[model samples]
Each structure stands twice: as C-alpha cells, then as structure tokens.
Target: MQFTTRPTLSGTFGMVSSTHWLASQSAMAVLEDGGNAYDAAVAGAFVLHVVEPHLNGPAGEVPILLAPADGEVRVLCGQGVAPAGATVAHYKGLGLDLVPGTGPLAAAVPGAFDAWLLLLRDHGTKSLADVLKYAIGYAEHGHAPVERVGETVETVRELFETEWTSSAEIYLPDGHPPRPGELLRNPALAATWQRLLAETAGAGDREAEIDAAREVWRSGFIAEALVRQAGRPTLDTSGERHTGTLTAADLAGWSAHYEAPATYDWNGWTLCKAGPWSQGPVLLQQLALLPPELPAQGSADYVHLLVEGCKLAMADREAWYGDADGADRVPLDDLLSPEYNAQRRRLVGDKASFELRPGAPGGRTPRLSAHALVAAVEGEGLDALG
Candidate 1:
C-alpha cells in the first residue's frame, strides 16, 4: 500500500486540518484555549476567508455537516437561496440562458457569516470575540500570501483593471499581484469584522452579543455595501457584464437553519449526507449500488468500476435532483430502497454504458435541466470509450 509522505499524528486533545496551514493553526489555537469543536471550526472558517479568499470569500456560501460528541449529526443549511429578484424570468430578461459563472449576476445571498455565527452562538463555549480574534489579527496584521492566490490574481489582473476596479484595489497592490510569501493585509475586511465586534460592547450576554453581530452583518455597512455594488454592472464569464439583483432586504430576511441528514446504512456503517438539494445523496446512492466486495485498490478494474458507478449516479442527479421542497423533488426513499437498488445493480455491466439511465420512482418522470440536455447533445461522439 502507498503511504502518505506525512504520517498522521495522534492526539488526545484535538486535530484540525484545513486547505491552508494558517487556518489549521487558527483552529488549533481555539482548541488549545479550551474551546469546543464548533468554536474551532468557526475560527478556522473565518481564517480561511481572510487567507484563502481566492477559494472562498465572506460573501460565499458553505454547506456544513456537524457531528457533536453526544448529539445527533445535523446539516447546517448555509447554502443561501436566490434573492427575491433572482428568477428564471429575470435572467431570461437579461438575455442569459445560464447564470454567469462569475460577477454580480452570479452572486447569492451571503450566508457564510450568518451560518458561522449561528453555529458559534448555539454550540460553542467561547465568546464571539475570542473565536474571531485569530481571523481579525490575520486580516489586519497581514499573513504570508499563498502562491495560488497570487496566480489567480495575476490571471484576472486584466479583468480587475478594466472592469472590476474594486477587486483590483484589494488584489493588486502597486499595480501588481503580491508575490507568494509576501505579507498581505485586508484592512477593509478586518475593519468590517472589527465593527461587528464593536457592536457587541453593550449586549446582555454571549448569545446577545452574537445576535448583535448578526444584526450588524445583515442590516449594517456590509448589507449597504453589497446593495450599492450589486447595482453596478460587472464582468462575468458569459462575455457580458451584468448587474446583480441581490438586495439588503434579501440579506436581512435570510438566516441559516439546521436540518436532519439523509442517512443510509451500509455494512454496519451508517453514512450521513446532506439531502437531494445537494450532491451528497448521489454519493450515498452510488455506495448503495456498489458490489459488497470489490477489487484491490488502485487496480484498473477498481478505478473503472468507480468511474462507471459515478457516471450512473450523476445521470440520476442531473435528471431528478432539485430543491427538496419543490414539487419535482427526488424521491430519495424509493431511490435508496433495497428493491430499487437491486434492480439498478443488475444494469451495471463489465463494459461501461454510454447512455444516461435515470430510474423512475412510482411512475414519476425525471426532470432534466436545459443545461443537461444541451450537454448531452453537444457531448455525443466525444466519449472517451468510443
């Protein structure tokens, strides 16, 4: 078996691993300071916003799964909903068939801030000030910038300069991307957090303090800034610049909530994942359809089987998955049933199938998105196996 270059370290206290080393350190600091897992996660997440802005930002959304030491596993629905003005009709009015991958039109209600705060307030043992200290410090005093951050900034330098001037002001210092290992400061974001912190001064208790911070984030300068900037056109991948529809009212109206996880039992291990609204259930369904016994890891057969299984699962996802509360929601119960999986398992063959096969549940017809249909048409004859 192949071994990792760095061996796993055993610890009785705790362990925190993130995409960035500084984020891991920030979480570890929380743990060392006697904070619980939720507190540590919140701290790490905020640090990630400052240090890995290229990957994720404060305005981005995140789907979190939290498993407490004694409590049941829960899903924190941090994936923000579309703003009130964001509708199929609205995008079509803009002459857009698809939402542009970047810029204003692509923005959703910023959920990460509220979600993290909710987790901290409800489950954490520490105060908001304590959890946020590391993030604020890093953003204010500066941290060593990663190579990828610099590379992404450099790649988008022209776009920033020409259209996204606000972005250029933050990313390009002295008209150039900051070099890797250089100290990078985001005083604006740091000040934003600090202002939120300042709002907690006269609160009654820890919970109240957190609540005050959430209110500030939703209705204060952050919301005002988003509302102002979203009204202006920005460049996007669709080769067109567009303005956003998100409003301050949208931010004020939204809050993160917890929900039960979708679970499936396989070989005495129960796997839990977010609902069909996410791609999580597709993974569970794929695992359910796999053979009880499998070939050796890293073997060609093993890789081929995994890939084929993924394709089959993804086809169903494209056809059936949508908002859980919607009329056309996936029938997850029937999809995961033993009888249904047994029937589906029979379709897996020695050779991979190029066809898209989506199972029908209780005679309900699958709903495929327009994007999927276009891809299916354009992807013909491009199949690697052919």
Candidate 2:
C-alpha cells in the first residue's frame, strides 16, 4: 500500500472494510515496531489469508509490486503459472475452455509466502515469528465469518464450485454457505502454517524463513490437502497424448518471477504497470482513442464507441498476451500508441454508424468477398432468370 521513491515522514494506507482495518492495524503494529514496508506487507497478506480467504488464500495466486525508497521499483509475480506439463492444447483435450478454480490440476506454484519471507530477510526489521504471530493466532483460535461472504457464495450458487465431495462438503455443507455470524475455523491450514514456522526456525533469521516456507508450501501436502478438501482423487494428468506433459515435478518446478513493470504518462498521473500479463495499457488504449472532450450527451453512441474499442483491444489481448519469459512478447505498445489511436479514431464519425470488416494480420481489412454473377438484360430481370 506504500508507494514512494524517496522516504518521507508519512504515507497512506488504503482499505475497504472493517476487517481490512484490523489487518492494517496489525501491519501498522509491525511498522510501529520499526518494521519496513516489506515487513508490513508480509504481515498484512497473512492476516488477509485468515480474514479474506474468499478473495485470496495460500491456495491462490497473489502477485505484487513493491516500490521502496531505494528509487528502484521491484515487482514480485505471485500469480501462479500453469505447471510445466500444462499447455493450451492440454486443457482443450480435457474438454475445458478454461481451467476451473482452485482445482488440483489448475493449482499453480504458490510463491507468495516465500516471496514475503524473502523480502523480510533482506529488508525487514521484525523477526519471522513476530510477523506471522498475528496470522497464526487467528488461524488457530478462529474468528466469526464475515457477513457479506456467505451471501456471495449463495448468490453464485457456488455454481462453479466443482462437484468434488471434499470441496463440496466443506463449502456446501447442508446445501448452504455458513451463515454470516457462524464461527469460521481452518485448523488444517493452521497446522501447515505451524510446520512452516518450525522449518524456518533453523534457517537464517528471516529471509531463510521465506525459502523454508516455500518448500513447505510446495510439499506433497499441498496436493494431498487439495485432494482431501476437493473430495476426490486427482483428475487425469495426462492431457491428450501429447498436450498434457505435466508430471508432479512440473508443479514443483513452477515459480513466480520478479521483474520491473512498465510505466506511462497520462492525464498528469504517472501511469505505471507491467507488460504482457498486466491489463493497464489496454485500458489506456480505449481512453486515448476517445475524443479529448466528452460527448454532448452520454448516449448509446458514446457507449457503443467504448465497447467497439474494447472489442478490438480484447481480441488483441487474447491473441497475444502471455508469459514474457516463456512466450513471445507481442508488440503491445503498438496497439495503444498515440499514432495508432489517432488513426483508429479518424475511422469513427458523428453521423450514422458504419460496419468495419476485420481482417488478417498487419492490421489490414480484407476486400469484400465476390458474389455469383446473375446478369440481367435492361428491363428484363425476370426474363433473364427464366
């Protein structure tokens, strides 16, 4: 939550809840105890695991970008990536358009806890035990389920909740989400956290804790627990004979990468982001393409223009966006460049709408298709057909 190139006397904290406030307070406790932003973030994320498991958890990906006072911005990609054996064609063969959530096979290499530990080792002021105490306490003792969460689960019908009994049993108990005031507990997750603590104890003070936690997280327990919770054995790992090459080792091999994010200057704000995976620049493309001033009335026309621009951008994203290290980095900037937007904007008009024929590569529209000839003599259209 803290962002700055140079250390100042103060900073701001952002949150949207009674619970986030509690987590922030814990983080602020770390800060007040002389911990750095890295330490605060680590503490906060762990707290979120217990308090905000719906949105995030040890079982989920959590990519982060940290900019400290060092003048260099560091990005930690906490988002999990598909296992080495996984590929686009692999899922297609599994009769899937997209891998479903928190599933065993869809489980990416979880690197958040490790990354947090690492950041602390190098920059943290508090010890590993100190940062984790709050979270561990919450996990072991338990807390009441937040009100809004149960509503969301019911609203979604947990429709995509995956039919496995282990998963269903835990979530759909009695065919319903836990009522808002219900006592929420996760002793298994707590046990895992404790093991991480023990493993990290012997390692070098704080940083090594991160490395140790990584190993614990990557252990077979991850797959086992997921299987137990999901209430089923692992799904077929061998995707079509050729597509799914993922062995369990592939899961262990995947890790989050670190890199610098891209930045742009727009509307006086210093727009910052990372490429390929990040969704920022695509939004800027739609914004820049619009006329500098707003339309007289926010009518269907204005909405239509935005959607059309989004369609073009989304098509480009699906076709090209991917892991930069593992795949080709598309010429993403080209799509949002001022020159490109200007040309595309020129195609728009204030009058009646026009249909645009999208074409193949090189951004060119294909010529209209030829039609069968049905020649007719002057004033003899019907006779000619006969």
Candidate 3:
C-alpha cells in the first residue's frame, strides 16, 4: 500500500484543479455545463487572472500541453516573443546591461489573450461569451481578495503611490490595501473583456468569433492601449524612468502556434514538455541525468541526488537554451540523446558541487550569455573586496 498525507482522489467524469478555489469551481462549472476539457481550462485560466492577480495576469505567457481523446499529446507554444525593437543594441544604448524586472519594457506581446482564444478556436466546444462569463462576473462584481493579493498590494504600495498611479487606482481601494476576505473588483479589466465580447458580434460561427476576438486583441483597442502605455515613460527596477520600444506592430506581428513537445522516456512512462525557449526542458534534462531507480520520496538520499542532478542541468540551460527561431539555438537533439546524458550523468557525485558546469553537447562548446558572464565577474570582484 502507498502511504500519502492527502486522501487519494478518484473520479470518472471530469475534474479541474487550480491554485484558487474560484478558478477550480469556474472550470468545474464549465465541465458540468457540457464544455470539454479545453473550454474548462480557458474558463479556469481567466478566473485565475482575476482572483490571483498577484501571481498571474492577462499580460503573462502560457505554455499548454493537451492530449485529445482521439489525438496525440501536443504543446501549444503560447510564450510570446520579444518585440522587434527589444534588441541588444537598444538596451546597450539605454545604458542598461539587464532588462528591468518591472515596467512595460519587460513585457512580451500579451500572448495569454490570443493563446486562450486559439485553444478555444481549435479544440474547445464553447462560445467566447460562455467561457468569459465567469471571469467577467468576478471582475465586475466583487470577489473576496486572497491573502497574498493583499500582501502583494502592500509590498508594492509605495511604488504604486509614487510611480504607477494607474495600478494604485485599481489595487488600492480607499487609499489602502484591502484586508483579507474584503471584496475587491476591477471594473476596467471587466470592461476590457466585455468590449472584446462585443466586438465579436456578427462573426459567422463560434470559430470565426474566436478569430475575430483574436484580431481585436492584436490590432484593435487592446493593441491601442498597450502601445499607448509602452510609449509613456515609467519608473522601473533600474531606478530610472524609461519609455518602452514596443510598438503596435510588435503586438500585431506575434501569434501563438502549436509545436511538438520534447519527450523523455523514463522507466515505463513518457514525459512531454515545452521546448528549449522555456525552463521546461531543464526538467527533462534533469530526469535524463538522474538515476532510473530513485530512492523513496522525501528521503535524504533522494533529495541530495535530485539537487545534484538539477545543478548540472540548470547550468546547461543558462548556457545553451534560447529562442528556437534564430540559427543559433538549443542543441536539443544531442542534449537529450542517450549517449550525451550517459556522459553528463557521470558528473553528479555524492558531494554538493558549487561550480557551474555546462556540458559540451555534440562536442560543441557552450557559450554563456553576456549577463551570466557579467554576474560572474561581479561576484569575483565582491569576493576580492571581502
């Protein structure tokens, strides 16, 4: 018998799981209302944007993996690409070595909007109105704010008040963060979605309506708002106000597409993950380096080995993995090969290793990013000063 802390759940019909109860309930409601898994996922994701605003939002990216009952498992590449103007030269000219962690400069094309619609267009069996109703209701009407939402608001309260007044208007009600369980609403976000739905009117069928909504998001009012904001100067983590280089063309140029998932067979199971552009491939590489027979879960030996395997894989991720569009990209085929992993696995030893060791895949030398090299040089300088 397998022992576990949580009760083993079993079900036959359908199930939905999410970080927030509201999101799960919204998905389950869709499932109960005869929507398929894809429909339920889209509904759930939108609710997460509303309820877990501290964590996820419409501007964020999504990498989706789905297996249709009649089809093979595939990955939907929802991760947005950087704007054309977001070049190394642009940032270098701006006197910045790294992109600010906050502000419009850090944003990619808002892929979550089109990606969710794309999934619904291709795989889902519901109308756009049907999927968005739950999120719209939550955003327009008040919903109890999560504890973390309040905490996140408090953390950024000073910044909101001083730098981002638009955010302050939405998050800070009555000039303060809402206490836990207090009802919070975002009428602006609700209006955005409502306008999207309104724009889809007169589109032929459900598929056409979804496509129309996609266009509205990319080139219509949504794009207008984003480009307007991008052109404005905003305070960032760099402690300087910088206007974004992203344009309306940048938002219009990008769209989410599907691609084959990278897979690794372990024991009797095949695991699928998004490709090199994401941190997902690191998980596959870690599995390849780890022993086939792992020690029991939660054991000290298991933890040690897992940590050791991860260090080697993470180092390679820092050095090799990047956007697949360019000529220079991840050597994924060679990295995942049995021969390559066998050679790399030998480096994981009993002791914890602090050195960053990126592997030479296909005998090609690994090149660390300029940012990584700079960080290393800075660390050495600090050490010398100490």
Candidate 4:
C-alpha cells in the first residue's frame, strides 16, 4: 500500500492510536504502567468520552472487539436495547413513523459505561480507579478544546440556549461556545465518575469493587438521575420535543455480554464482525460480494464496485437487520452464505441501482420497517462501508 503518511513503526512494548492524541497518550501510559491491552483500551475509551463529547459520549453505545494474545476473538456487545415503553404503538401514538435522530426519544439504555467496566473487570488487570483517573483528570482539570467541538457547540447554541437548558449548562459556558484550543472542563462529568469510584471504596477486592461500581451505575444514583431527567421533554430532529421513555428499570435490567462474532472466510483469512444488530456485518457482506481480484485502490472502477457493493449490503441491512431477539428473524446464515453472495454478485452492473434489492433467505420475505423504507426511499440510508 502507498503511504499517504509515515510508515508504520516497529514496536515490542505496545502501540495506541485514537481520533484524539490525548486518548493515545492515556492508553500508552496504562501500558507503560504494566496494564494489559484491555486496560489501556478502557482508559482510552473513557478519555474519548471526555475530550470527544461531540463525537461520542458516556451515554452512547460502543461495540468492542477483543483479540487477546492467546485467546480467540470475541465481541463485547454494548449496544443498548430499546426501552420497554419504546414500543411501536407509543411512537405511532406520537405521530412518529421513525425515531427522531436527535433528542430524548432517541436515547436508548446507556451502555458504554457498563461495557467498558465489564471489559476492565473480565479482561483487564488495572483497577477501576486507575482506568478512570485519566478521564477524571481531563474532565476536572480541562483539556484543549477540539475545533469540531467548538463548531458543534456553535451549531447547537440556539437549541441549547432555548430548548435544552441542561445541555446549555454544560456546553455553553457564560452563554457562549468555548473557543478552539481553550481549556474546557466538565466538572459535572468528573464528579459523576468520582462518585462511582467512591461507591466502591468499601469493596473487599478489585473484582468486587468493579462489580460495586457497575451496580451503582445501573441501580443507584445514575439510574435515578437518568429516569428523572428523561421525564422532561427535549428538542428533537422532528421539531417536536418529547420525553424519554428510558426508565430506571431499563438501566437496571441491562448488562453487557460477550458473544461470538459473525465470521467470513476469504482465501486464508477469517474476518469477524459484530452480528447484524450493528453495521459491522455490512462490510463483511460487501467483501463477500466483491471479486477476488479488482482494480487498483481508489481507481474509478474500484470505487464504483465498492460503493455499489455497499449499497447492496445496506439494502439488506435496512430490510432485515435488528436486535437478535426472536424465533422468526432474518436468516443471516443464508444471507452470508457463498451461494447467496454469488447470486448478489450477479446483480452488480456498470450503472448504479436506485432500487432496493433484498435477497430472499429460505423463501422468507425480508421485513423492512416503515422507517427504514422511508430512509431508503429518501436516498439517505447509504453508508461508506469500506
């Protein structure tokens, strides 16, 4: 591959890369201090939550892939489930054919925190205090504000100022967005992490302490706070404000778990990804559909093929993929099978297809949700899968 940047460095100890530099530094520090890769990842993820709040937050979901030195690859599921009250009837009652992309109604059960904690507890060696210290420090002492963060805050300044006052209290300091490179502190977030740490003070062991912190996050003050705040309506993308349906019961009932990843074998390599519940498998499907040999990377033909493949895969995603919870679900096995891919490959042509083509699996008709179909029809559903 041509190097658009510097060549890779040879390392024996460890390496860390993240969207933000501080997160890399934080992970490297953990590794340098004798913590394992899992510990480093946990520390890095928390720092991302602090410094890249505009991109991701503590309340967001994260699906993790862990491949240890001696163990097989595993997927840590952090994708939160829909709240019990988040039923089709409830949303339909509100005249919403689709969940608004932004606002309180879009909020699911918060899963990232428990996901990280679970990774640390099961696969990591560092204590919760150690893993969290970097994030807490950054949140309390302030980190250099990223330009995108400033821009995002500015874009939402009016919304924050008027509708989401709670958000304004955090993002808008003194009624204005923080300038880029300015030191910005989130004392409230820092206190939240600190309080979780404090709750584990009396635990007998590191494992027990981690468990205690998890409990606090689920059933304690965190759950109570989320449930209370969700009672109030918030501004959403539909221009209709709505209260969140996420309850304390939802938070308490959910827990992160590990599962086998969906795998695709090509040549001698075995690639893995999260199940259809996430967007991960779409890439795998695209790869499966492509010819073994192709045009040079970034060439017009290559780009065309990749883009078309992704469009096809995403069509399948929209039609069938969802939380794996029912007896009668999308037949993922048949969809990923070689026979199905060969059939799908035949559909690719010189021209782009605006029509949605979802393959039939075991004669079962693909069920596309009304919202998904709308997104597909509007031509807003295609994602760059490569």
Q: Candidate 1: where are CA atoms >4 Å away? A: 380-386
The segments of candidate 4 whose C-alpha lies over 4 angstroms from its true place after superposition are: 1-3, 375-386
Q: lDDT tens digits, residues 170-201, model 1?
A: 78988988777788998888888888888777
RMSD value for candidate 1: 2.7
Model 2: ten consecutive residues of lowest lDDT: 367-376
TM-score of 4: 0.94
Reference-based lDDT, residue 266, model 3: 81
lDDT against the true structure, each candidate: 0.84, 0.59, 0.86, 0.86
65-165, model 3: which lDDT tens digit per residue?
98889989998888888989999899889999889999877977777888888999999999999999999999999799888888989988888898778
Task: List model 4 lDDT by residue over 288-386, tens digit each.
Answer: 898878989889999989988998888888776878453137567887888888888888899877766776656666767766666656764333211
Query: Candidate 3 — which residues are off by over 4 angstroms?
Result: 1-5, 374-386
**Considering summed lDDT, which 10 consecutive residues are worst modelled in model 3?**
377-386
TM-score of each prediction = 0.94, 0.72, 0.94, 0.94
Return the clash pairs for model 1, or none.
none
